[model samples]
Target: MDSGIICNNALITLIAIQNPVDRKAIERIKEMKNWQKKEFGQEIITLLRSL
Candidate 1:
């Protein structure tokens, strides 16, 4: 799927985790522009895949 969808799913998973969610960070991510989200998501995906 596209980076945006992947990013959203990742965020959802993070929120579902037992650990405390960082509301401020989530809000910042949610406020990001579409292109920014796409780039950020793609980078994250790439980084994770490389690990």
Candidate 2:
């Protein structure tokens, strides 16, 4: 549960930092194959790096 909260908060922070419109990045992230296996930090890093 702790990790879940952390991941959720991290996502909110990440999105807000990105001006809230680049939410497409978040959607693209959801569509990525095998997304469930990624750590929250890893996923965020990958998305940011691609930006």
Candidate 3:
């Protein structure tokens, strides 16, 4: 239950930081890949580091 709340809040915060359309796209991609919030965040960091 706690983890679910955290994931939900993290999604909301991520959406707030990015454009609304981009946020939905990202969320969908993450869901398709079956990634938890922490893994999704790590993937983002790795991608950013390569830029």
Candidate 4:
């Protein structure tokens, strides 16, 4: 089930769990080296904030 977009498991897992973001998670996301991870993290945060 590829969406034809770069995948980020950390964000995927975070969203799958449907848990609120905490400072530790934010920091961990920031420390990720992959661009997809960072992008997904941002998207997740944005999505969460809009709710």
Candidate 5:
């Protein structure tokens, strides 16, 4: 599950379902963060984008 390749896809979905927000805005932020690093933090961003 943890191959050093952070999976932002799942985290984003969980958070989005829990808290709704503007899609476009969140996607922008997620992309920016993804460029920075795919660490655990980035996973959360990915989840948001998925939603």
Candidate 6:
């Protein structure tokens, strides 16, 4: 399986936990390089928005 897909699946699981989106989560996303952001940004944004 693609590593990006694997990572995204893990992210989905993490988001499933009841905790609120924290500064650390936002910072981690911000720390991602442009290419990484391109790979995962939209899914992250969509998931967080759904919360």
The best candidate in terms of lDDT: 4
Model 3 alpha-carbon drift over 4 Å, by segment: 1-36
Q: Give the alpha carbon lDDT tens digit for every residue of 1-51 in model 3.
A: 676644566664664465334334556544323455335555554554465
Number of backbone-clashing residue pairs for each candidate, in the order shown:
0, 0, 0, 0, 4, 0
lDDT of 5 by residue, 1-51 (tens): 763334355654554555424444445444335543334344555655686
Clashing pairs in 3: none
lDDT of each: 0.48, 0.49, 0.49, 0.56, 0.47, 0.55
Cα RMSDs of all predictions?
A: 11.0, 9.8, 10.9, 4.5, 7.4, 4.8
- What's each prediction's TM-score? 0.30, 0.29, 0.28, 0.39, 0.25, 0.40
TM-score: model 3 vs. ground truth: 0.28
lDDT of 3: 0.49
Across 1-51, the per-residue lDDT of candidate 6 in tens digits comes to 777644666555654553325444644653355665566556666677786
Q: Write one digit per residue (lDDT tens) for candidate 2, span 1-51.
A: 676544566655655475322335555544333443243435655666776
Minimum summed lDDT over a 10-residue window in model 1 is located at 18-27
Q: Once model 1 is optimally superposed onto the true structure by TM-score, how far is the C-alpha of residue 13 displaced, in angstroms?
A: 8.2
Off by over 4 Å in 1: 1-36
> What residue runs in model 5 are displaced by over 4 Å at the alpha carbon?
1-7, 20-51
Clashes of 2: 0
Colliding residue pairs in candidate 5: 8-43, 12-47, 12-48, 13-47
Q: Give per-residue lDDT, candidate 2, residue 11.
A: 57
Which of the two candidates, 4 or 5, achieves a greater lDDT against the reference? 4
